[model samples]
Target chain A: MSLVMAGVVGALFGAGLLVSGMTQPAKVIGFLDVAGGWDPSLAFVMGGAVVVYGLAWRLVRARRREPWFDAAFHLPTRRDLDARLLGGAAIFGVGWGLGGLCPGPGLVAAGGGATTGLAFVAAMLVGLLAQRRFARG
Target chain B: MPTSWLLALGGGALIGAASALLFLTHGRIAGISGVLGGLLPPAAPDRAWRLAFLVGLVAAGVAGAVVAPSAIGASVRPLLAVVAAGLLVGFGTGLGSGCTSGHGVCGLSRGSPRSLAAVMTFMATGAATAFVAGVVS
Candidate 1:
């Protein structure tokens, strides 16, 4: 059941990328180029998503229990803007501007058959693994 | 009708829908950062939820390709660059204690002040990253 769900979720996410042209790095680059050719399309997408998620959140919370599965709600507790956050954001930005492939879209790109995605995914896993190895309590 | 708009709507809808589904079925917030965080240690008895969440995420992409042939295709971005970017994000997520899903989508929607700060940091870093990459490379 989990496998089926993951596959479905991944597909929809990928399709979103494909449909939004986000899976294509050039498009992302184009959007990033403010002076040359500023494409605000991604921003619009972000806005729309924000609106939808806002409403859905309410509907979900209204129910005593969730509509489908059983699990606890999770949210971050950390508030300080520390080194990890600062440094990581710096690295992520560099990658986005240089590579235009963040984790979500990167995963979607790989699923779409981009060889480069394989590398990104591999590195992402490594990053995840590295964090696990060195995580502090 | 427009390709760009289509892309935005599609991605946004998928993400929003997935967010809603995750919220409905599981009481989980559908934030990627938190979802991945569960992998850390002592393996919570609720490990099944995390596993299921990740699986559904991937499956969504897989099924989309099968059904939406027009949506699946290779992408750009060099492999090495993307790998570096992935590592950066891994580190960033660790530091920030969340990612776009947790903050940009779920956090902000939930009226989380911290999420607002995190999202701001994410966009600022993203913008700066693009600036340097554009100028340097």
Candidate 2:
């Protein structure tokens, strides 16, 4: 049941990405190109998402002590701003600008069998595995 | 607001709603990178739901492509650049511990200072990269 629920949630999220144009590399790049013909659509998307989620978070905290399917909330507890976070994010940003495809959108497009999406996802998985291997050593 | 902008906002709300639903039922953040990355090594016991979620995400992509092909937009970047971007994105997200979904959406909604910093850093660098890429190409 929980697995089904998770799938439903994932589908909903993917639909949102599709609707918001996140799956469109050109649209994403346009948003990022502030010095060029800046598109503010992505900002609106983020703003809407943040507001809704923020409200829902408050409501959940006030109403429930524990989740229905889990023992406890698995929330991030770290508050410190560290070099790893900043540096990694900086690198990710460059890649995002170049590709205009993040994990969610990339996965979605790949699933749809786009050649470019498949290629990107393949390289991404390799990179992910490489990072883990490096970290372990 | 334009129709596209309104659609973007609505789409974002859907993403947020999905996140909220996952949190409400499973007590998990809908961080795409974290959820997908956790499936790598030292696999968690709760891998079932994660796999289910990804399956649903992919399924949605397929559905969207069939129903609304234009929204899924094609990539203009060459294969090599796309691959490079994919590698950087995967490695960087692994190092940062989150991507846009995790830090930009969930973390910010929860009012995490760390997330704020990460978002700021990535947004700045992403814009800068886009600007440079535009200049060069």
Candidate 3:
């Protein structure tokens, strides 16, 4: 059941990726262009997402527990703003801005049937490995 | 623009909804960046959330397809490449302490200085890759 649900989510997410034209690298780049023909779609996408999330988070917080779930809410524990976190974020941003296929879109693409997504996903993993080599206890 | 915009909005909602739901239920974030990041040096507890998160992600895709049959695209990337990318992302997540959504959506929104840094780096790298792959390579 859970596995099936996961696949369904990926498909929906991927469908969204396709619909948003994000699967096309050029579109993603356009959005990132800032000074060029800037595609404000990214902002809209983010806006829509954050808005929904904000509402969900508020609802969950009010309940003190997630309805239909088994755990308490979690917020970040380490607030030191360390180098590892910063470095990782930078790498991730570069990848997203460049490829237009961060983790979310990658999974969606994988489901949607894009081979380039494979490359993006692979490189992403390698990046992960490199980061782990320096993982702290 | 309409196809992409609508899709992007819907996609963002789906992605956000899944993550939000999971977090609300599990008290966890669905940032692939962080979940994969935590998996390195994997053991029992570390694997639990990581696996669950992934399972949930995949399940979501399947469900999305069934719910909205029209959204499915008829495209396929090389399977080998896709698997390779997944492995690479596994590694990247380990090092970076998160993947795109983990850092890009959840972390960045929360004002995590690290997520901001991570987002910057990857966006650049992705752009560099696209420039090379799409234009140069």
Candidate 4:
């Protein structure tokens, strides 16, 4: 059941990404180009997502003691601001601007038969593997 | 165009719904980076759901190609740039512990202060990089 739910949710998320024009690296890059040919479509996508998630999350949190598949909510509890967070985010930002492929969209776009998207995901997997091997915390 | 806005909003809503479903059912954040990251190291007990989610995500693009090919844009970048971008994105997301879906979408919706900071930093940096890259090119 949990797997089924995960699959369903993921499918919806991927479809949303495509529909929002996020599969297009150029479109995503356009959104980030404030001083150039700027596109505000991605902003609208974020806005629409936040609004819905905010309302629905609140209602769900209010009534639920635990999730249907888990004993407790596995939310993040960290609050402190740290260099690791800032530096990592900065790096992520550079990559995002460079290629316009975040994790989710990268995978989705690869599924759409984009060679560059496949390249991105493959490299990303290497990065992830490297982190696990070298950075033990 | 107005249709762009409509699609953006509509697609975003679906993304939110997917996230919400995952959260409500599994008590876990729908963070793509984290989810995929876990698989690299092979967190045995939780692998099934993550794999299912990813499969569904890919299916979405495959389906989109058949139904709405225009929505699924082709890749547009040199191979080297794409690989480097992927490496940065992977490392950064691993270091930071989340990506756009996790931090920008789920974190912001949950009103996490840390996520807010991450979002601001990444957005600013992303925009700045794109703007500067444009100037350079």
Highest-lDDT candidate: 2
lDDT of 1 by residue, B2-102 (tens): 67776686677667777766665565666665566666563455666666666655554555556664554444445666778778776667566667666
Give candidate 1 misplaced runs (Cα > 4 Å): A1-10, A65-67, A77-83, B40-45, B60-77
Tens-digit per-residue lDDT, A1-137, candidate 4? 88888898899999999998888888888999988878888888888888988888888999999999889988999988898788888989988888888999899878877787789999999887776666785
Each candidate's lDDT (Cα)? 0.64, 0.89, 0.57, 0.86
Top-scoring candidate (DockQ): 2
Instruction: Kindly indicate the candidate among 1 and 2 with the higher lDDT.
Output: 2
Give candidate 4 regions above 4 Å deviation.
B42-44
- What proportion of the real contacts between chains A and B does each prediction keep? 0.49, 0.78, 0.40, 0.77
- What is the Cα-based lDDT of residue A11 in candidate 4? 96
Distance from true position, residue B106, model 2, in Å? Answer: 0.4
**DockQ score of each predicted structure, in the order shown:** 0.50, 0.85, 0.34, 0.80
lDDT score for candidate 1 against the true structure: 0.64
lDDT of 3 at B65: 51
User: What's the DockQ of model 4?
Assistant: 0.80
Residue A37 lDDT in candidate 1? 65
Ranking by DockQ: 2, 4, 1, 3
Q: Write the per-residue lDDT of candidate 2 for residues B1-137, one digit (tens) a residue.
A: 79889989998999899999989999999999889888988667789888998888888899998999887879868889899989989988888888899999999999899888988988888899888888888
Q: Which ten residues in a row have the lowest lDDT in candidate 2 chain A?
A: A126-135
Q: For candidate 4, what's the RMSD?
A: 1.4
Task: State the lDDT of candidate 1 residue by residue for A11-127, as single tens digits.
Answer: 554455556656566667667766546777876566666788788878777765534545455545655556666555555566666667666666665654557666776776677
Among all windows of 10 consecutive residues in model 4 chain A, the one with the lowest summed lDDT is A128-137
Ordered by TM-score, highest first, the candidates read: 2, 4, 1, 3
Q: State which docking tier applies to candidate 3.
A: acceptable
